[model samples]
Target: MEIEGVRTDRLGLLLDQFDQAREMARVRLAGLGDDEYLWEPVPGCWSIRRRDEAVTPRAFGPGEWVLDKGAPDIPASEYAEVVRQAADGMTVAKIADDWSVGVERVEQVLAHTGPPEPDTSPVATIAWRLGHVHSNFEGQWEWTFGERKDPGLLVDFTPSAALALERFWASIDRWRDSVASVTEEQLDTVGFSRYPHSNDAECPYVTVLAGANLEFIHHMAETALLRDLWRTRFTTSG
Candidate 1:
């Protein structure tokens, strides 16, 4: 069915670009080591570390389901930090290159990974950070493929962070197919998804999906930066 948006077929095109960006990011990060993967190039920059010694108050926030908050016009200092804070550094290589054989296996692995034992510094494997990053694209899948029963019903990982990742990723094909079937009318239909959304009686599905698209793009960008930092920091550490 034709999705109810700027155009019936435009959704696929839009998502294609999103997929492309994610794939590129994944390609770069596939073989990176954890130590290098966690490196942050900028001074005073945060990459995912434990709050050890409390020198800097490490902070992180979920960017899902939030209204655009909009972008800055001139890229001001404050605005740049806002953008940086909102971004979650992740590579596109899920499923195959990630933790397990299946998409859902990722969550299982994560679950096993367990939450930080407590008060540890924000390491690369931040408590909930990996899972949070994985879920960033979930809202889009739900909006395009199926509606999320509850936004809070985030996909959780188990058994060392593999559970959630594996489970969710296992269903990626299903998600892609589901999104392809979306109708434009359904996208614009208000109340189709949930509340606290821009389109109370509008095509929230499409809009959220659009946000997801942007998120996927962001993930790729983040991954690229992380991988680049990795290459720079340790590749030559002989």
Candidate 2:
């Protein structure tokens, strides 16, 4: 199959994956109200909050809305599972795949000898998940395709659901554009993406693109699940 004249090669596959993920996200986000967007299913959930209301030790973005992120507190069971996987000779990639997170994130968890600090990795609100996914696209677009300028502390964290959806869509478009513009030579080139968040600088561009597609796929699925939970929160099983 061909997409916009691009053959169904490696690059095409990546783009197709991204397109499908984006469409799923769009459908999942439709008619998302503000209350649902910021709904915290449990206490101490990390989410997009007003600067004054921020609870995390460190919050990113200069806007009135900040994203809460910290060293996630891994549950004892989860930590043990990682150890068990490692003992079973599972590669980092396999462990990461099982956890549905990036290898680097999995490595970080594995590097720790004990559980993380308390009040960390709280259940995240839909807003928080959307913010995280949007940030990845925005940051990668800035470093990879746009001027290799650092976005600095100027992240546009939107507190309103409507505005957040708008920004998220724009970011997706930018990321898709960047991926679509890559040439075969560029895909094989090292350091094709100057994205500072990961090992993109050391790996081939194709590796970076594939990793990003995985990120989008997993996060969007997670966000969709959150929406489902929100919709069914008040339902009775009887």
Candidate 3:
């Protein structure tokens, strides 16, 4: 379809992809119970927890529950800078002063060996995956269609599977509506989506839509696999 001689085929394709992925996620998440949603197949899995029960170094959310993604690690480049500053006769305090960070952070950089040789990201539970999906859509919608406010670290991680499902589905619907409302010119316009969390500001709005669709597809598939594993865990253990 062409609107004022602007082709909307690409936009239609993106919307179709988004709808299909959303339906797949909906079916995969149907009948999810708290036991399966929060199931940790292995020790040290990341998931949603009550703010008081959170064990990760950094947990995010404004409510009683938080999503416990691990804390950010200081990059090796920063550690090298710390080493250079130390070699230049800068005390830890001086280094901290120059960097405008705390002395403990500077010390941590100096003491850091490196990130793990092999990536050791913990397995994420369904709750964590759903929260991530919801946040992505919510943030994208906010920056793209609604107010351009930064969503920041304020995630709404709920312990209830039903509420999580409802929130994510609503988020998807909002994102879909926003995409549908955009014109072809807007789709080709760069910086149409001012989502601060990602590089969407650099890419054309169509690229952002494609990327977001793929993100939903990728994470939802992972969630489905986790559900399958959860269902078979007892048999596998036996």
Candidate 4:
């Protein structure tokens, strides 16, 4: 599992999982049928169903939105149940799609670019990914690197509603250029974050990164799956 021409290491592990997830995502996308909007595997899940919203997923039930967006002033209890349940049923492509670029910004940029394809596609959708990445950012910053922010409900940046993935598609590189600069030390440093979890006296940063890597890939798979499914639906119905 090599990336950017670098031999395998812990980052390789995370990237390997990401690569495997990409393959799984391709398979799942290949399976999607046509004309199946308003459907998610865990249909029992709840979400904010409406246009003009973020692309967050359903957790617990309806009205389960995370109030804070990585800020430490709020209680984790607000989004704890949501995050806890997130660990239960995970998929990489959806996670990737969920890891979208901010819809508004993406859309604004893509308006000139046209074709919303990128929004559902990886690389383009940076909103959810940024949030997901921040999950790492939160840990790396406050705990591992020891920054000074809570990186509040990193998930809330997600919308319970579907997003303009095409526009999202256009925004991928925005983060790529930024994240590409992250160093091993930045990821390994302790005490960058002020969040309770990051600042925990007992826990360490390496472990936090290890776990975050597994999850980051899972959502990537989930996002890819969603887009592939959406593609199937688009082709069959159109």
Clashing pairs in 3: none
* Model 2 Cα lDDT, one tens digit per residue, 1-238: 6767776898888987888888887898899999999999899898998989889977777778899977433454467667767886889896776555788877877887754445334688889988888887777888888776555453688779999988788778877886888998999998988877655676689988998898888888888999899889889988
Candidate 1: how large is its RMSD? Answer: 15.7
C-alpha local distance difference test of each model: 0.44, 0.80, 0.80, 0.38
lDDT of 3 by residue, 54-94 (tens): 98987777788988867554345456656876886879886
- The better candidate by lDDT, 2 or 4, is 2
Error of 2 at 233 (Å): 0.9
Better of 1 and 3 by lDDT: 3
Which digits, one per residue and each the tens of the lDDT, describe model 1 over residues 104-149?
4333333333333333232332213334455444544554346554
TM-score for all models, in order of appearance = 0.49, 0.78, 0.75, 0.37
- The numbered model that scores best in TM-score is 2
Q: What tens-digit string does per-residue lDDT give for candidate 4 at 118-235?
A: 3212122223343344444443444333444444433233342233232222232232233335566744655332345432232243445455556556666655655665557546
Model 2 segments more than 4 A misplaced = 1-6, 72-120, 152-154
lDDT of 3 at 118: 49
- Give the 10-residue window scoring lowest on summed lDDT in candidate 1: 65-74
Runs of candidate 1 with Cα error greater than 4 angstroms are 1-8, 37-130, 139-153, 157-173, 195-204, 234-238
